[model samples]
Target: MTDAVLHPDSVRARKADVPVVLGADGAPVDWVKVFLGFGGMVVGQFMAMLDIQIVASSLTQIQSGIGATADEISWVQTIYLLAEVVVMPLTAYLTKMWGTRNFYVVAVIGFIITSVAVGLSSSVAMMIVFRALQGLFAGAMIPPVFATAMTVFPPERRITANVIVGLIVTLSSTIGPTLGGHLTDLLSWRWLFFINIPVGLLVIFLVGRYANFDKGDPSLSKGVDWWGLGLMTAFLLSMQFVLEEGNDEGWFDDGMILWLTVTAVLTGIAFIWRQLVYWQPIVSLAPFRDRNFSLGIVMTFVTGLSLFGGTFLMPIFLGQVRGFSSAEVGNTMLVSGLTMFLSAPIAGRIVRMMDLRISMILGFALAAWAIQLGARVTDEWGFWEFFTLQVARGLGTMVAMIAAQQMSVASLPVTMMKDASGLINLIRNVGGAIGLALLTTILSHQTAVHYMDIATAASTANAASTGLMDGLTQVMGARGAADPEGMAAKAMSAMIRREASVLSFGDAFAALALGCWVAMALAFFTRPVKVDTGRPQGGGH
Candidate 1:
């Protein structure tokens, strides 16, 4: 169904009167055209995100194939994320000039090229370059998809439209991790990229054939606030670089770290100012003037942190702590992906029938609570425990994520929604960056603090320590001598690691809990826009 905004005149018109596409008499939109156009979008988006996680599940296999160090291998994820975030703000401008129809098609083409290139890459450098390119276009494509939907959709069904979009997006989300993981296990890692070729080609054909909407003026997109985009990019890229390298470089003492910190701060400030004052601003800040929109933006930002942060952490836990293979970690997410896929439509239906705010509050609360449950997990935790957590996340995210997205956007003018939605995505990108950095740093710090305490305990130095000495004595006796001191030290080493694990997981849990509160607060403060029920008009700002 096209988005049906309720307006004064439209209140009297049946749902069929709403125009979703162009007509001489302003006839109702063709829902079939919209669904087909949108379906292509979902396919492309799903393909992109799927490639990312699929590669994740097969990292070990790729490492062996390409012969790169762990440091270099990190580029696979980092470069892709960087590329995607870098181009996000530009998407609004691009679509404005080019029309979403043209913009999305081109973006998909770029992504497809990179996907194919990645499959053909013979070296690490080539892979990184192509991956970055793919990310750039993929980044540009998402906002316009929604914008087109909003622009063409009728107002009354705005929330419902978002729910449908969300359901499709969720499907993409799950498909990436699930299919990618399964493919990685069944085939080699390179197949992950190779797999995109056929699907991408099909999308290209469909988009060309069906999404033939007229291209608007190109100048709108081309006159991007490059200054703004540049600064924002540098700030994000630098900050991410620092976070990724801080541990290895020994934190602030490193000269590179100091320079990056300075650059990032400067660029971030410039970016904010550009948004506030620049004429023909690359990004529009107008949507943020509304309290509901602003609050919703905050929720979206915080939720991004939780979403991406959890996406990063879960695989690490499965692979590093539990000794599961990369394939296993990916497969685990796949299971949760299935649950998410199933729950999305259900979530959409509920939102259509119920107050979205209630569903969102509950959803965010539940997701936060579930992540907290993960804190208590030991290395001994079975697959079932984590599976349960994923199911909870699947359901909660369905509620909070969709509710937040719809409420925040429903009030914006259709023309301006591309920019608004793009900006929201950008915020989420930054939030994900901050979340990942902060979570990793906190985990490391807490683990170190715990490790040091246990390692330096007086009991270890003293032979009289009860359990410590007893365990030591037995090991020594087995070695044919009572070397109590050495045995005590070894025992401390073993026990301290477990303590560190507990502390690290606890920190992650705490972070997720805080994120939930932020999302809830955003939802609470949002004021719903009053729709005119008598006639259909742009409910847009």
Candidate 2:
């Protein structure tokens, strides 16, 4: 294999005398195997993501079914996300402690078990606990899913693998709500949990059958960073508390939020210090030394805001504001999911040939454009506009996401690959949670401001919009048709409320546009690397 590097026109570089293999640089790889492996991991990933939103969609029904309050029902989702975020960093260690194979197997099984438990549960508490448990073990599914595809395929073939991976991840995130809603509406809400059973079992069976590979135990072999794990978990938990409950508690006004804020800060500082100073960190921080890895985190974080935030907004806006059924919300999001599936592989293909920086730049450009499209929401807008925007977002997501994901790992040492992937993805998950909470709160605030603004404007009684009292009378009549006088008063109030909703939704859409502007900075952080191939110009395969 003694070969000299020679530039080539077909690709960036060509191997001198390496064995000519299929999709190995210039050779094609075992794409069928790679896609099968990638697809299996994606199934696992989609199931995990589906769980997060499925709970939210089912909560109202579950709440009534189980006799729970709004606060109590929130736990269905909160528990899953909390477990998912908490388990994310831990999964890296588990992968090393066990092996990627054993880890994924265990993860898939645990997910299936929990999914079933959640479905068969007798009470909400039991379901929450099982859901949390599902979140915990299933956390191992994501990063490893990507790593499996990368490992199975050669460099040239990496594009194909990522396209599949990207499609799965994109669909899981974008279409989760739609899928959740469908399962909830047509079937019992419990079907959401039950659905994962068959899919997860299939994934597990496939991995056992085809995706077999070692998940090296670096912790036992490498020694567990016990102290680091505990500290990081504490830090994440504290931060989550602040973000999840801050608005409810009036920000700093609540003692619990204040305490959690302080704990998060202190624990976070300690965690970082231990990582930098310790010779053997719990989760190694060296991969982050790669500028690409750091940039990847930034990109994933900002991108998460748009991805998760939009997904959260649509259902709530459609259902809470427009009074659409759960199924309708699902149908709306299905467009985004399908579009992402279509766009990912294409983005993956071109990304391999393009400069890392160039691909990332283009990806962000698409993402920014998508956000601009979403910023024009109106109460009266039809499904087509929503579908168009979601598809654009989906397209932008694949380009930016896969580009960011691949570039981050390309330069890392093979040994740190799995852990590094986990860390970068951990940042993305945390970012998604934070994004959801932040945007929801922002949407809430903006809606209020817009509502009041519109209400104030209407008080004087314009030709187009009557006074608030008058609008209320008309809406009350519509809402409460039993008593004429009472209905008139209620109708008047409801008209004002509908006007408030329109203004609020518009304001929320505009507010989210600002976050996309911040995410555009991710393009700047990416380093430009010239493309390289595994060959010399005239070398034989």
Candidate 3:
């Protein structure tokens, strides 16, 4: 054959009528199949994220259904998170072994089956088992979607893909409680898992048919790092257990917590060492060599802290302090979800137009300011009072998340995208775990401190305290209560507890605001990436 006939460009030129877009690797890009497959993965991602907090508002119902005590019921959520975290770092290795299409489809099918099993569970043990399996399967769905966004799309279209993924990440988690509350009220808590069936089948169909982004390397499975994988699992499971149960079980004072903490520290160190030295590491550490990736990982960790911390605190405040029902709390929380949805498109534009570091700084600063506003909350603060704060939070989260996601992987080689994506996600989850633990500890300790201070101040010596007690006693006596003074004292104690809880929430908000400020400062250290504004040079199909 002649040189012209043999040339790749000439070969493509001969089929001009068939129009093709070349990816970074010089392969023809099927935009339709990419999007269709990607859309399915995104939906799967949404389902997984949504499941994280979907049971939040309906925990009591689930507990009742399964005959679980309040103490045992929390394991339903905790187990899933623990299992999910353990599987995340291993995603890159698994993806290489099975290919993206096979790995993702198997995960979804497993998730769906476990979902059905979870819904049919009749006891707490059965529920936890199925939930853990469900989480394992669902964990496989997240990191690959992120890796796909970076690898499958060309540079110019990456921001758009990142924006969509960011939206799904934030929006689904934000609205989970609200959606769960409605579903539980209308149908039943069992419907939460059942709802995933139809949607998941659709995902399987789309992904199985169209997700052909990469080929599997069966050779990579030959020299598996069993030691590294074992150490990693032990470390993650122990660490997650320590974080999840530490506060509830009295931190270091509890024997199990103390032992687990030691195990976590020891195993974590060993796991890192194993990964660094192993010939075929289950999880690669090479991605950390990139400065931008390291910095982006830090920013993502803080984002998760703020995202999950804020989500956790608001519902507690609404439920405990304001006495809002699950539905009302969900309704109030919907403000942040709506704001995130509305600001997503705007965030995409800003990410494209602004320098990434500047965009990150702006985003983190806005979130910090908004959270500081929340620090001034009162017992009477409700939906309208939190409106502006939620709006700022929503906007800030979208912008920073998209920028962080881009910065974390954009500079890495295509070969490292999978590892980097998985690492980024893993760090974010660890941040969230740490944030929740710290916030819960602070809330509990601060509440006790505040309660004592307030109680001491409201003594018999204080005229206002005496007058209030007398007034309450007179009102109870007028209502024909036999023990007016005793009832008034109890009422005063309850009031003090309520005030203390509110104050503790404010303290938590301030802590989160401080984290945002720290993240904003760190943004300055990230190097700027050169933007690729040039459109893909190819004929339109």
Candidate 4:
């Protein structure tokens, strides 16, 4: 190829040396290697996701084991997220330099090594350091898996592959907490990290045997965009620190938080400038120009919000509001996992047969309804009460995720697949972070406001309040408890707090439902994508 066509940043170009495989029907066939390659990739991806979920459930146990305070232990998760998001957008460039197979092999091996180090860690600081390293490699493994699915098969088979990817993604998150709780309860918390060893080894061997993607493009590395790298890293790291710390540190009220916020904004601007102007930008921003890709990314953000936000809120509601154990909280999510397992293949078929717009609209609509229903939750809710909600979440999640993936990259050229994959996945992760932050803030602020409102109303000499107090006093008297008046007041106060907490949860779910509706509206803007009949390679899919 000529220099102009050979430019790695030439979004219109594809290397001539790459091979394309087609089936007897004159469509690109799903390579047998894809099954082995993507399957193994899924395993590694599962480990990464499982690690996050496992730690979330076992946070208290881990904190006690490492002799860390509650505040300090939060960094174990914060640092991992920081590292993961920072590396996700850099995958395409890194793969070009190291070659896809070589890069993936190294990442898998590094992940295994770090998992062991994390398991053996003796101090909070040591665990954080190792976890950050693990997150780096783990994050690197994810984009490639998605990119592989997009390229491995024709548009016809791509939906199936995407569904499989969605299945593992949803399943890992659903099962993580329950499994982690069991491991920590029956064995040591260190076993959570140890569990990755055998799986990681298996993944490494499978990837080595079956990976057939691009080896590498040496020319792409000739002009490294160091300026772009610096600005991007600055933006991601500063923003992560701010997001994770802003709520606890009082947001912009703290001087350090304020300064970092400004720094993140400036770096963010500079990074955008570099990507638009620099010839060989580390991240390709070209995908956003396509209408379908851009709109689909919006839907992806909503999907992330629901997935991560629901996961974050459920445990807090169950564990704190209902006074359930970690194991019980995890058990409540099993319904979601089971539903996803059964629903994803059906979703894949729906995407294959129905119009893309209809598929996405249906998916987002179900998700919105599910989240809205979750708003009806009360303090008295048990596992059965959440059944329909979990079922809706699972079905909605599978449908939305599969349709969103297809819609996002459907119109992009093959050469842009790698960058587009990385960008789409990055947006999803950022969405999750933003969603979790918003939900947590809502819960805190709303709980305090509701408590104050109830307290104020209680202070007024209302007849209903008087009746409640009298009833409580009578119950205490009937039980022959000491200090009936004091016990009645305490009981009333606890009741007020519980009601306030449930109200806060309801508010959070309502907000999530509104977000889903907005995503569904955006789905209409995506340009229609037509599957090519010719035996084309990655681009047309």
Instruction: Identify the candidate with maximal TM-score.
Output: 3
Question: In the order shown, what is each candidate's alpha-carbon RMSD?
Answer: 4.1, 5.7, 4.8, 5.1
Cα error of candidate 1 at position 470, Å: 1.6
Deviation from native of the Cα of residue 427 in model 4, angstroms: 1.1
Candidate no. 1 TM-score: 0.87
- In model 1, which range of ten residues has the least summed lDDT? 1-10
Ranked candidates, highest lDDT first: 3, 4, 1, 2
TM-score of 2: 0.83
Looking at candidate 4, what is the lDDT of residue 476?
A: 99
Model 4 residue runs over 4 Å out of place are 1-30, 185-187, 474-487, 532-541
Q: Which portions of model 3 miss their true places by more than 4 Å?
A: 1-20, 23-27, 533-541
For candidate 3, lDDT tens digit of each residue in 496-531? 999999999999999999999999999888777765
The residue ranges of model 2 lying beyond 4 angstroms of the native Cα positions read: 1-39, 173-191, 218-223, 458-497, 531-541
lDDT at 46, model 2: 73
User: What TM-score should be assigned to candidate 4?
Assistant: 0.90
Best by lDDT: 3
